[model samples]
Target: MELLRSLAAALAVGVLIGIERGWRQREAADGSRVSGLRTFGLLGLAGGLASHMPESLAAVIGLAVTASLVLGYRSEQARTASLSITNTLVGIITFALGYMAGQGLVSETLAVAAVTTLILTLRQQSHAMLKGMSHKEVESIATVDYR
Candidate 1:
């Protein structure tokens, strides 16, 4: 039915992003990565399902999701001694896209999902670009002073 299709799209979105995350963290030991394929997949499904619930219930579910993501990130920071929020942000975005798809904005959801995955895939290139830049160059770029 229509709900099934929406949920399927949501799952697909999650899998798409999960592919990038899983591949990027393939070398990390189990439980080390902030989230892998299964976690993202569940998040996407949760988004779709939450979209179908009553507005109040949906809001509560969203809050729960956000809280869980924040807590997970804090736990990860403790274990890794790093403070990156990229994975958490990506997870939230994926959930949003799934919700959009559930709300019948399929094309827009897919488009943004593609862009999201592209950004996630570019992490190495982004880091390399910054690492290759001089401090002055970075400051100039940050300040929008092309001169």
Candidate 2:
């Protein structure tokens, strides 16, 4: 059925993203990371499942997931003394993509997932680029882009 296809798409997206996340976090000490392959996969599945429900139900589920991610972020920060919200944002995105896939927007979901995976996988390069950039240069670019 269509629902099965959606769920499959969601699962594939989760696993695809998870491969990158898991690879990045593989060296981290266990229990330090907020999420890895399994958690992301479940989040995607949850989103897909909720997508078939009423709009209010889906909204509530999304809000609840957001709150949970926020709490997880706080917990991670407390443990590590420093943490980025990138994982939390990815979680939200994964969920949304799953919902989109469930709604039969499979191509768009796959495209976004590919872009998200690329971003997540390029953390080191991204950080290096940011670190190498001067504040003035960043400001200039931002000002020009905004204008």
Candidate 3:
């Protein structure tokens, strides 16, 4: 029963985050370079599966996911990407941890899910704010000028 509960919570969290990502992907004008709803959902599910497995295996799975995210980010950076896609990946891992902490059968995972969803949902607004800033303003903050 406890295991079932944890799985449900994890699944719910994954789905919630996935929905937000999906919405953002659909609305994005320039389109996102990151994996969206389905990918996020699967990642969360995989995390949950890892968490339920033996400790060593779970650690391996987590490490693999982290490594993949790092490699993906590095690849994107090499291509001069703007938005960081790793946030979704991080959210999935964190959500899995939260589910594990919640022990799979409580509202605690919901709270975690809410926070993750909020971040994913607000990404566009955050990007817009960054985009709206002037190069001079950024340079002033950084105390360095390109020119």
Candidate 4:
């Protein structure tokens, strides 16, 4: 079925991102992460299912997902005292990617997922490159408005 395919694509997106996240946090304790492979997969599926609903209902589901992600981040922040929000941001993005899959843009969705996963995988390389760059260069990059 079409819905099944979309959900499967969504799961694939989540699993792709989740692989990176899981590997990144491999050194951390077993269950301390805000989200890892399983949670992201479920979130992806949830997004796909939500997308099948009415517009207003989908919006409500999105809100619930956002709220849950924020709360999970908050809890993990309290435990780890980590100010970094990269994982939370990625989780949110994974949801959006799922929504894209649900929209039947399978090829485009996979492309975006690949790009996002590449970015996620390049964190260390990105930071290392920044070390050689001047402040203005970094500032310009940081301040550039894509909009």
Candidate 5:
């Protein structure tokens, strides 16, 4: 019953982030290296489940999964141009924290998760503006003769 509740909380957190990503069309069509809201939420639940195991084992598994997600995103970004994995990872961690909150481990997990979500959500606009600036710079340079 507790596990179910934890899972539900995790899924809710995941879905919240997922809805945003899906609405923004942040995922790739090929689905190769992308980790959207659902993936992140599931990963968090899995991490929570793993936490039930021995502490050392849980820590190792969590770190391994987090590292893999990061590396996978880096590789995917190099191969194809799209949203970075940092925000996705943040979502995953947020979901995990939500699960922890559901399990009664921490009192402020929801607040922390909300803040993290906000940070991730805002990143899109900052990145887009940066890209736009780069584009403007390139265009301006193109118009100026080097010779």
Candidate 6:
């Protein structure tokens, strides 16, 4: 019924995110990336399910999921010396959106998810724009404190 609908919404949120994320990393060799569509989908599902638990339990579960994603990011960063935290942040956001869905906030969840996916989808264009910028152009916009 309602729960099923919520879960479906939650899963949809994950799929949306996963599509963008997977597309962003399409150049990476197979099995190279730590997460893809299925992983994101599962994370969303987990968040929705966690919402059904008692309040304290839900909080604990949320913390655990966040911690795990952070730790995984840290581990990958250390191993590869990569500085990006975008994937981890996306995972956390997806989970939150799923939790929102479970709480009967499907519209809000979808809106946020759409925004997040848009950001992910714009990666190449953003990088291209940055690369096209002159040094002075970048310096002029950068907010650095002289003092």
Candidate 2 per-residue lDDT over residues 36-108, each given as its tens digit:
8888887788788889999999999999999998899888888888768888899899898889888988888
Whole-model Cα lDDT of every candidate shown, in order: 0.85, 0.87, 0.67, 0.86, 0.64, 0.90
Give lDDT tens digits, candidate 3, residues 1-147.
777667666666677777776666676555443656666666666766777778898878777777776777777677766476655366546546543633554476677678767876777799999999999988898996569
Listed in order, each prediction's TM-score against the native is: 0.88, 0.90, 0.67, 0.90, 0.65, 0.85
| Superposed model 2: Cα runs more than 4 Å off | 143-147
lDDT of 6 by residue, 96-143 (tens): 989999999999999999999988888889999988999988788796
Looking at candidate 1, the ten consecutive residues that score lowest on lDDT are 29-38
| Pairwise lDDT winner, candidates 2 and 6 | 6
What is the number of residue pairs that collide in model 2? 0
User: Which residue pairs does candidate 4 place in steric collision?
Assistant: none
- Where does model 4 exceed 4 Å of error? 136-147
Q: Clash number for every model?
A: 0, 0, 2, 0, 0, 0
Model 1 per-residue lDDT at 24: 88
After superposition, candidate 3 runs with Cα above 4 Å error: 27-33, 83-95, 98-102, 124-147
> Candidate 3, after superposition: displacement of residue 31 in Å?
10
Show where candidate 6 strays beyond 4 Å.
Answer: 130-147
Model 5 lDDT per residue over 99-135, tens place: 4755655436556666666766787697887677877
Candidates 2 and 3, the one with greater TM-score: 2
Name model 5 segments beyond 4 Å from true: 30-33, 81-85, 95-99, 124-147
User: What is the C-alpha RMSD, rounded to one decimal, of candidate 6?
Assistant: 3.8
Give the CA lDDT, 0 to 100, for residue 102 in model 1. Answer: 84
Per-residue lDDT of model 4, residues 65-104, tens digit only? 8898899888888887889888888888888889889999
Shift in Å, residue 18, candidate 1: 0.9
